[model samples]
Target: MTAKKEVVMGASTENPAEIQDGGAMELVRVPAWEVKYKLDRNPDELAHFVCCRDLDWRRAVCGYEEPEAVILENPTTFCTMCVEVVQAHGGVPGSGRCPFDDQPCPDDETVDRMIDERTSRP
Candidate 1:
């Protein structure tokens, strides 16, 4: 059996969750305060605090709408819903529900494919 090669990547704040070299994209842990500072008044830029689940679906990720969400996802006072979903998803949920979204769950075909490819090995 060959071990899967791990590649560490740093995505720009403009495009945070891009999957690189066919690898699962791990979100860079940017502090909520720093994000606000960098974003300034750029509405298009992402202001994620608690993995808004708004990332690229191909990367198998996203949710919240900012400011308030950022505050809620603070290390000291994260929202219960956010924490629960995060826990359920193993840090990054394949089909996790976002606290901001009304829908219960989101589609994640990438995760299904990854499971099949990794587990079907003999």
Candidate 2:
């Protein structure tokens, strides 16, 4: 069998009128704290965070609300109740529940405790 050559697409040419003679491109700056916080979180967690942001943006931009569902397959995923809330609010993949709230617990420490508990158990 003969090997087939793949065709490549070229980059589109830029418009001359779009370029400014003296004006320089301005870079929009996001807060350093936000960047640092985002980086410190796990990639999967970050994806969920971004999803929440996108949901908010969608609501603001077009008044369109996405249906949210809580995935409870994994401990890391959101709880079923939270998913229902997200769906009611028109969000997709609602925020997860704290893993360590058997009776009553603080939100911040629950995740770390849950991780420890899960790791210790198995």
Candidate 3:
């Protein structure tokens, strides 16, 4: 099989999970810090900053909103749903466990790989 040609694409902080590929759409790894920082501030502000500043989305791919979550046996990814859960639970301090899992959240590398593989399809 021929290797898929990887293309560089930009994504907004408001919705990083969705990526534009070949006029179609695919999900990809959007660094954790981008999501976390966006979660910390107003979504509109974050989106504006991302557009104006062209923030680096690959630098901190392992950031977490909750200080404790990062130290858990398995760290969880900071995604759109994760942000919603955190907000519903009253932010990081109020969120004690992973919303999706009973144990803990998945790690950064694990989440990144998952996204990469899913989006690398031909």
lDDT of candidate 1 over 1-122, digit per residue (tens):
00011111234444423444333334444432232211133343332233323332111112333322111111232334444555555543324544334345424465334323333424
User: Per-residue lDDT of 1-122 in model 2, one digit per residue for the tens?
Assistant: 00001111122225444344322222122221222111122323311222211211111111222233221112253234434444555544422522222122225355344333322422
TM-score of each: 0.23, 0.20, 0.26
For model 1, the superposed segments whose C-alpha errors exceed 4 Å read 1-62, 67-75, 92-122
TM value for model 3 = 0.26
Error of 3 at 7 (Å): 23
> For each predicted model, how many residue pairs clash, with residues at least 3 apart or on different chains?
6, 4, 1
State the lDDT of candidate 3 residue by residue for 81-115, as single tens digits: 43454445444422333422333433546544533
Q: Which segments of model 3 are wrong by more than 4 Å? A: 1-85, 90-97, 100-102
Instruction: List per-candidate RMSD values in Å.
Output: 16.3, 18.9, 14.9
2 against 3, candidate with superior lDDT: 3
